[model samples]
Target chain A: MSELTLKANIDRPDDFYADLLAAHEGLPKAQSDALNARLILVLANQVGDREVLKDALAAAKQAMHRDPARS
Target chain B: MTKIFETPLYPYERSADQDAAEPVRHPVVVIGAGPIGLAAAIDLARHDVPVVILDENDKVSWGSRAICFAKRPLEILDRLGCGQEMVDKGVQWNLGKVFFGDRKVYDFNLLPEEGHHRPAFINLQQYYFEEYLVNRARALEAEGKPIDLRGGSKVTAVEAKDDGVLLTVETPDGPYRIAADWVIACDGAGSPVRSMMGLDFVGRVFEDNFLIADVVMEAGFPTERWFWFDPPFNKGQSALLHKQPDNVWRIDLQLGWDIDKEKEKKPENVIPRLKAMLGEDAKFELEWVSIYTFQCRRMEKFRHGRVIFAGDAAHQVSPFGARGANSGLQDTDNLIWKLKLVMEGKAPETLLDSYDAERVHAADENILNSSRSTDFITPKSDQSRIFRDAVLDLAEHFEFARPIVNSGRLSVPATYDGSPLNGPDVAGMPDRTRPGAPAVDAPIGNGWLLSRLGDRFQLMTIDADAPDRIDVEGIEVERLELSTNDDPSGALAERYLGDAQAGIYLMRPDQHVAARWTKFNEAELRSAVNTATGALSNRVETPD
Candidate 1:
């Protein structure tokens, strides 16, 4: 059981969504993917405590894996 | 006597030409009486060009807008005869301290090199800077070269021409019209002249709004700049503190994009923010408070046939790095010299094209730095914030990470890296002061090297005598005899004569390096000047 928490953290989701899209605007598909990869590693480092990073990683992998609701 | 820091307003007077029956024509007309416009007038007067400046307002800046004056602008002011006065009245500082929460990340130094006339930067309000320039312009006016500075005169209409510009101006008394051989728009970021032409001024707009408040307090704060990412009082946003003259402290707080700007500017709302940074019991009165949002924008082209744009009128940047005024003064510096030559029929009309080329490059550089600093301080995404925080945290431990921390990289002079005016880099050339770079100051005998090399083409030959009867017109040879150890500090030798023993160099009137060679010849120097003045080509290299 990963101790990762997903909550409503954003104050305004609409503006955040627009900004996220703006960041990826001029970038090519491959470059956008590279930016996402770098962004993940940076976030992992700030999650500083390795246990928290592992927990976040497990939660992210679970999201990407076969649908949990369907399973 | 209570110390009065408020700026005195100058009364607008009726110009002698207001009653003229015919439209009075001038060599040049400068709009807006800010630092850029006054500099244009003063620089033109120094070159014996008659100029007239118009400003709608009679007073200087209300607050301490553009508090930091960089070294390059200081040098330009020094040439205009107000540099020393500004330095005498302003507080000089070079060190800046950056912090993450309660811990100091790193302290950095600017202008490490010595023997220069001006310091790295000075903290003075925009009012004082404008006063000095206005006084200098008046002094020039008394000496036969008249700079007619008209306040309370607003330009209502501007029509283009094949050779000149027709300006319809409205004064306090009545409406009048004037014509100029050329018109320069220095009317600030909300430039009316640019808008009259229906030009699109567009760029990236940062969503973050900053609350800048100036407080008059007697607390013993150091003169150096202090910037904190997330201090104890402020939870997540960044803050900055800097000391100005007259016990005034400038505090900049990052108010998130969602705050009410009108309510935040009220004294009731601003006092608490100041208390949070200073103390609960801090005895301070708010002198000024304003909320500002920055945009990094510029016109598509600075030159519009007979009309031209400069300073904030042409381009703008975020105020975080103090690039606004510094780069604007650079625009006047680059424009006036070329305009003088062109008006005098000495240089071709194409010389003005280089002003557009060089300053647009400079504007882009400032915008890039300012935009990046804004992103670093106010990261949009959590991932972006994570990287910023990681840099802030790692900066405390790793020396390599310290350079990556960005808290408004202080303004430095722009280098025209690949300018067409640049000549070939000859043997034994120096690095920073290379071709297309502004000349650096060093000690030469009793005075500084830059003082001797004013508004004329200078040929400084180190350790070697200048050749006699050099046939290139307008080129003045200045022979520097720095015989090995004569320059005890080796500052002159290092800047002019490279390590490989290169001695001869050619400099443009604006003090940019044109060409350099060990051997002196007339033909090569002439060709270099032709290139420097845009004589060889008509178009500047546009970015692809």
Candidate 2:
């Protein structure tokens, strides 16, 4: 029932990652953290489905506690 | 200058009922002369029901409270015969600008479309609003209407009986006992009648204070709402500015919790805050200053036997959205007509319960919206503030984030989506005029749609044939036939019919759509009329 694409879905993964980091360049930690929060909110609105958002939140939380070495 | 609040508009006078041998029983006794109570009395009296309004004070309120009047309440006032005067004297505005720090964010319009009779909102002092209502009441009384406005008469005690309510009203002379077949308590937030009945509101109490200052000044500021968030003047707080009639402006500054309210309200202390918001060189005189901390709460139920609660007596909400008086006006507008029907025995007594259900639904909506606005304005935790500030920060750059910004989701009429009294809703019709929604105003001929709909049950037909009148049991449903050609602007069909070719709409006395069908069906129309009047036995089917 979940429509969230948890797997890699971007066309250019490295370029997208580089752009995300570049957007936060020349900014302090607080400013970068605020920008991240704002980006999440803006994207959540774009992904307006509540069910998808909920699944994405759970998946994100699960990854935070997962053992990185298992990957 | 002598203000209107200083004059006794309805000073106390000994009534004939007070001197009677037995407690005189009236049809209805309203327990306050505030705007809500007065409007209720006027509405009941307009229906030929004898009504009495008892209040402790003789004049309008002392301060400029509840300054913003929304369009729905303005339309309700039109039904009560004072809308024109309010619009004439009040400052009409629809544009609002939101600010963050010293920078201006996007400005929005409350009413973007046209063809509606009333403006989106008007700014008028509560005193002037009450004075206009009082004048209407006096006019009705002069025309030999069955209405009484007794000032300085305080209702000290209330006993709700199976048949009626016994009230002890203390007047200028002495206390007297009076009884009414039904009682409407509109005595405001700290309702004495509610206390006498051992009732209490249940909800959240916000922990913040707002200082409201009404000042008289000559300024070049346009008639638009200006709201500031964390400006240089008021650091880390929100502020609102609105222009009212008579060169007077209302300013609200968010003073964080744990401040001395008395010291904050002092003119010497308040003038500096005003000078900072309005430049230091601006000249102004303080008219009124008060500190208010609000709660979002309401009674568990609005009705209990012969005693019913309306206005702030029934529910209370934070003032951020101007929902206090606006919703109260709506409460009475939804109630009085149903009370009239029940009193006349044309509708079942169960109809009163729908008032409880529908208005409690509206109250919950108002509470939810105003509470959200309060939370946004005064974020509780550090995380919430971060998110709030992020939205404001992003709003300056992106249009998507602007909608996330919640200054106050200003008051709009509540749509009773799942009200028990709602009838049927056919598919393919516009949702704006769906069942249980208030009738949208559209230009018809030279007049407006709402002006012709309220005051009684009407069967409105748009390019659909219907009988002139239909009487279900004892209630009469008159017909209002219209064609799309009548409105050259094409607003009527666009609002009432989307893709449907023709429509037949059943409207209640409150001008809410009870049911709509694509074509005329006699049995369905009859059943819908029965259901709308709370005649449970005639209900053929339940609405999904």
Candidate 3:
């Protein structure tokens, strides 16, 4: 569903990942979950691509399957 | 201190039941004699229906409440016989400018092309507007078309029966009872009748408060709508400026969620805020000052049993967009004619249901627009603020993003699309006048096309001869013919019929299109009439 051409957007992957984890630091589980949800929606609006958002949603949901082989 | 507006308080007369042996059973009784209520009574009265209008207040609105009158309402009031006077008294303008943080982002001309009777918008104090309506109502009353406008009389109780509604009014003397077949409640947003009937006047109440100040000044500001986001005077809030009659200016300052109401209303506090916006040399006297929270909410149903609601009582929108009073006036416009037809036994009661469906739809639109404007003006969330600012920033240079800069979505007449009362659309006709849209006005002869849409069903024909006359059971339908030279601009024919050569449009009493076709047969016209009046229809005629 994504309009993604499998393009890499972030140049500094480690720093981006570190900052995301840092955003969740010291927060309770519920609050941290809310922060992630808000961030995802905010970024989606920034993307302004419905197909990409839907594809990202399917991909994230698929990753939630937690198959041992895929992991 | 500025003097209060000179509005004469009418004497309250006791109900006829107080003097007579039996209570007067009227056909219709309207509650809360505000602009909408008075308009309803006047309209019904004009339709030869006797109406009793009760109100708690003895005078017009305390201040300039609903200041902007859009074009549609002016047209409706024209039929009620008071449109021209209001237009003459009001300041009419169409240009609006929007700013974002010291940058003039976008400006709009509401009526880009003009051959119409009314302007896009008019700025008149609500009190003055209501006074004009009340005077017109009185004029009709003097002409013997009965409009019992009882001021200082408040309806305290409402009891709905199988046939009609019984009302209990609290006057200076005592509470008296009267029964009417129908009741229209226009008693402001805090409707006693709605509360008494246990309806949820529900919706979102915006946390942001705006200090509304009407100041009298002889300034050089042009008659245009000016909106500012993060203006130099107000650091991070939005503000609005509109010029009204009597050299008065209406300014709205966006105050945050919490503030000391009394302190904010003080002259010392309000004056400095005005000074910051209009510069230090702007000498002005405050005429009226009040604080209001933005509320974009409405009732699910405007009609209940034998009782109905209109105006602020039925729906309330944010002050932005000027939808509140404008939509309310439209509510009455959509209602009165139907009420007349039903009361006269010309149509079935089902005809009234269209008012509920149609106005609820209109109210929903107003709420959606008002809420969006509120969000854009306030932008509670950081990301939304970022997006809004981005639109504003882009709008400064590029034309594409200009529309995203939302100051207010001004009120426009609602089209009753997909309404049960509307007949199925035919091909070749444009969507603007297709069975649900308002009839487009055009310059015909020396008058306007809309001005001729009398209070009856009409078949407007373009480039074709009209039907002789429709003598139906409960309706009077007439035909109006217009040739190519009738409209010099040709916008009317273009919008109403697309590229079609000729057509017939069946319009309802309220000037809403009920049906349209490139060609219509008598049977189809009758079917459309039946459907429009809430009567069941079985006949069908295909367009040639």
Candidate 4:
């Protein structure tokens, strides 16, 4: 069985990490980015739009940065 | 000054002339303030359309008429910011049980649930549902995005105009008139608006009348649904026990063909029927009781010029499948988007015709299913009774007969095939990938993802071969790659596409699939986009 790896591009490092933190607001910082990455990919796959995915990613990132407590 | 019939509620002291005077016209006028009407008004108002919603009732009705809300309607409510609140207030259930004549037959559960953020179904009162919607309507009104709720105002006449409609309404003060670009009748089954338009509602009246009673039991019965075929209490009829929100239960008793519907409503007659079902010693107080005749009918046309009919006004189905109010709300859901498009001039008046096509199809499907359910349980004729009994008997020994006993197919969503939006492969095709079907699971960034994206319009090829081919102006496209099996070790699939193959799938805003292609070709994809949008020659250049 092959281990499917999913990767996505993040325009900004802090934004990506921030979105990661916000998505996993209740989780430890170590798990937040990985979880955020997974969530972003899922939504992008659903919308299937590179633009909306980017917008969703940026929004998630901004939310995390606004409140580190979200992490 | 002449003595005025003013009350504390009339703080503005509004006069007959002032109330009757024509005000600035809006793009849409929605009649009725019930849950369906308010829900329709909320969505249209959110899209910035000037809307007026009128209801003859001064206040929302009480009693938990509609108890169960499906996942789809719940999701729609959530989008309007009221779903979460509804979830908080209602009891959620996904598992239900069925009984055949006092014996447990089988049970089923809503399988493979999606979305960690959303629940499958909620049991809440229609009264509370209206409360949430009305609050939203009032809040929007405060912000000047008002829903224009004219409570206690009755529409006496509605005439469609070239530009819109002219409505003659009677208010507390006096009669007044209103003109708008569109008029929607959501006033319910006995809609005056539907009558004034002279639209013929056609269908057959069932032979059986149901004595519906809502009672508070000493102890909660099974949380799941229970149906008894030919129960001893009713002798030759079937009985249904369903859970309502609060600590109550709704029971339906079949009154055979010979009983008078009006006389059956009398408490004396209703009490005996209720007592028989509750048992000789069981004690319960009835909240409300009514004798309802079943009719599976729909207006021949949902629209008369600029005036449209929605909910019960447009169609009526038996309560066997809980299709009445639920279908009405779904009607509004389908209409709101098209109305928004026409209001914005994004689509022509022809687009409004699709409302009748799609919704009438839905209504027809509901009627067919509900009628079948009624037939199976009621068994009007001797031949039908024999057939139903034979099936129920076979259901005991054969798994094949189990589905018939439970009727799962009746609950599934119906397609809008007659719809011009539907393309080839629609005929005789299974509903799995059809238009208006729920969204499916797809590979996103790193994991399996399922979502309903095309809530407003159809989306074709987000990331395709050539970025320059899409022609609809103002249409947005996204370009991206997913991992394909051909390149198992390639970064595209392993790193970005969640280990999935590269393919293009078109989505409708309601999150149903329109079409899919394994590979992208610019000319082919361009044509697909045009077909999906119904744009014909209305093409615009795309950014490379």
Candidate 5:
């Protein structure tokens, strides 16, 4: 998924995601997506809660739906 | 025996006793007395490990260098018990401003609230930073800890012996050799130690050169990073201004390859550039001016034979993002535990190679990202510059262009993949942790987020009610009640969470998550813990 989309999907503090998106600016789509995926997996695993993981997945999917490349 | 003249083993060579020196042997020999190297020495000495540090220079530099330290390094300084002193001496800036021409385009509030332990970034001169480190080392030495500072001694030859490294040093009087159990080279970019080992410093060098001037100013410039694209003074160039702690403002001018670097930085020529940008009415005294060429290079292997590399000796990133010294400090942080473990005989020497592999990966990733950032900020070719300008222009009017304009990737931590530490994600669950980003708060037990900030390996299990279900090794597990009925604020109960109750989270010493798991089905977590703790694969596992 695109970094911007992946960030929006996760339930992190708004400022956190905003800061992340800001940093991801000017990056290629593939790079953005790879970084997004890496973050999601690591965080979901770190949080160690299936519920949070589900939330992240749903959010990621919804975010993907809003963007063509990510979908 | 007394009448016979003593002869050295290398009959033609000099012995290690020309100058008046102590006969004490150090367990570790750390080359380079920079902040990171000093931090490592102080840490090892405090931990009761004999450490000897050597620096080529007689003393630290007086000028301000490496003006920024990120949260991670500050946290490390905190662990070394000097974080508060650094905070007191350094300027903490939580906001960064970006300008497109004279118009300010982007601004970020690094830490909107004050509850977090650390702000986004701290600005301090490298010299003062080293001063604090030297003081700490001296204090430790005074307290009977064997932290030796051999100033003016430069390592000229490093030969790997069966037991340890035979380090050859050039003293003012003559040459001397010491057999160190292990060696850590933190010498800056022109690392003689790294070169001696024949390690490759691989990366691309940018054509752009910076004419940096540190000046004491009476102007009321805000203490924030201000970047100007197509600045008025140099239309095709870039300018950045930041206020230092001593009321000095650092100005950087991007002079493309065509300009004569040496002549451009001369006071007479540089003064006019400063005047045109800051206005003729502004009064400021120039502290120092120098031309710097930015490049991104990382050593392919941080460890060779019996020696290891840290700091700029291992890798260097473009200064645009302030990742150079920061990354070096992180390298020391990563290597400290392994060094201690190997020295204490708790783990085998083979574990040392992981330090090289893991840190090399981190350095390479940082190098690429920083280089990409430099490319975005200062494009070389006309086409790329046009593209950059077009994006910045589109950002002004188009709602869709905001993300592109405000990309926050520069501050995002470099992520680690290809790491054997990461657990497999079979559930196809969406990942939330960005590469190199900090771990998010989650309920693993009766856990308070910010309180667990220091060096400890935390293992969280899925059986929140009964965390004893999984028998993990070499880590402390904090069981969080992921039950929806128990702690409603549990990670499962979050508005963002859908279905998660049983899993595992492995946290590193720095509180950064190292790996995660759902069940103890595979031996991955156990092995990862072993790896993190410097245990050999065949070594007896720590009892659960």
Candidate 6:
């Protein structure tokens, strides 16, 4: 019973994906990992709600372990 | 191609003061004849104050510098009597486009509201700006207004005393001494006057260099500000493009720290960069080239006993926001009025402290904004760069992220909120005309509101009753009566009165709101004026 918005919010996900990939180009593995870490922190700060962040963490952890072939 | 800079506009001449045995004393002596000094002298002379200006150079600045002039400064120039010519010759535009990588993320219009007289901004060379100011000074001098512009007169030393300051000025002939009751230092960032008095600015120095190339070209690009972040040509740096008058385009390319400063300025190295930005077939001629690294810093206080500092001498900001000259103009706009009042003995000397307070507040705001823009352009760390790129990436399609992208918040007049000079504010009136805010311009009949308010203390009444004039302890406060019917467009009422039916406002000479009320009250009005002119120490007491 949280007020966090969990839905397909992005209008054009493909364009955003391309931009994200382009931003990570010409970087080493360590730098790219650093970038992802920074990006997560930035987006988390933008979200700002502790309840929403907790929900997002739980959802992302669950997605990491789900079976791809069965789903 | 000889330009205005080559001709000596105010060359060295022998003066009578040099031969006198005793040092000649003047009412006010201004150091540095740049935009700020010239403006201060002109404003003082316009008010019948005798002033003198000293500068090392005899002509306008050499190259096209400080291209962007904001509307507020243009309005200030109007009060100085040179705004129309500047607006006529300047390339006016309000649209600005921002690009990330190669694709444009968003664009913005600075001034969307109508009924204002001046445009949002104009791009003109610094040389032309100084030329226009010098012309105005000459006109004032011809009419026997007390203003002396002494070229090639450089101050070698300064000494402050209990009541005045003595300046040792080195000229082509020899050194001469002059004393003034007050000295204004409009000398730039490396201020000799400040150094002589052992004063320093405390702030940050941005560790990046930008290459400025003013090129003459015939191109069809629209007159708008175009800013790029990590363009393909630059490949990890920011760039800025602006169009100036006389077919000259100003281009700024960010170069990382620890680069060869002199070798990059060579035409051989600069031409290839231009070719890469503009295709090989495109033709252009380089007019001037320079590299600059900026510092965001300001003095602890602008007023130091008898010697006062204005403009770059008091504060310095990065060039991203075009706040340098624009803020300097506002500095003179804020200082001259207070100084005039104090010199006339109508107000106590404490009035000058408000200048230091107000302009220092403005300097901090400018520094904060320009520093943020610099950080966004050149991220200090890899993590910061990642977050910056993330903001840019999300900004391409998302509406919420656009506000986070900072491509230099353009210069606007500072509202002296909580300033010592601010008087009082009513609850129900519009916030735009609140205490300490500059009067919002509105079309009143055939003229503008700002034109009628400034130059003296004013009592502006809109659909309210007030006297024709009031004398506040020998200072005259004229009344400007207006109604919604005066402005057929209704902008005046909308801007001045929101939920209220009528309003009365007390305005300072600088046209900032000193106080406002829903109805006319003489006692409260007198108290507000006293507070604004630094005549009263306590807060305004409202009578029950």
What is the descending DockQ order? 2, 6, 3, 1, 5, 4
Please give, for every candidate in the order listed, the TM-score of chain B alone compared with the true chain B: 0.95, 0.98, 0.96, 0.84, 0.83, 0.98
After superposing candidate 1 on the true structure, give the runs of residues whose Cα lies further than 4 Å from its correct spot.
A1-71, B1-9, B468-486, B537-544
Per-residue lDDT of model 4, residues B1-544, tens digit only: 2111121111222333345446446678898877788888888887788788877666555456666676667666755657777888787666666666666666667653442345555677676677778778777778788567777677898887788888877776777787888888899888888888777888989877777887877754667666777777877777877776666777888777788877888888888888887777777877767677868899998978788899888899887766777777777777777777667665566767777887888898988888888778877676566556656655665555556663323344455664665533323333455544555434444543333343454333323443533434444434333334323334323322332233455554444455555456555445544444455455523435
lDDT of 5 at B148: 76
Q: How displaced is residue B373 in candidate 3, in Å?
A: 0.5
Between candidates 1 and 5, the TM-score winner: 1
Q: iRMS values in order, in angstroms?
A: 7.2, 1.0, 8.5, 23.6, 11.7, 3.5
Error of 5 at B30 (Å): 0.7
Tell me the tens digit of each residue's lDDT in model 3 across B482-517: 675787788777777687888788888889899887
In model 4, state the lDDT of residue A56. Answer: 61
lDDT of 1: 0.81
Better of 1 and 2 by DockQ: 2
Off by over 4 Å in 4: A1-71, B1-23, B110-120, B142-144, B260-263, B281-283, B406-410, B423-431, B441-455, B458-471, B475-500, B519-533, B536-544
Question: Per-candidate DockQ versus the true complex?
Answer: 0.04, 0.61, 0.08, 0.01, 0.03, 0.13
Residue-by-residue lDDT tens digits, candidate 1, B416-442: 878877775665667867887888888
Q: Per-residue lDDT tens digits of candidate 5, residues B336-452?
A: 766776676655677677677777888877777787778877877765665566666555555444455422244334455655434444343225542123354443345434344
Give lDDT for model 6.
Answer: 0.89
**Decreasing lDDT order of the candidates:** 2, 6, 3, 1, 5, 4
Query: What tens-digit string does per-residue lDDT give for candidate 6 at B281-360?
Result: 76999999999999999999999988899999999999978999999999999998889888889888888999999999
TM-score of each: 0.86, 0.96, 0.89, 0.75, 0.75, 0.90
Superposition TM-score, candidate 2 onto the true structure: 0.96
Output the worst ten-in-a-row residue range by lDDT, candidate 2 chain B. Answer: B535-544
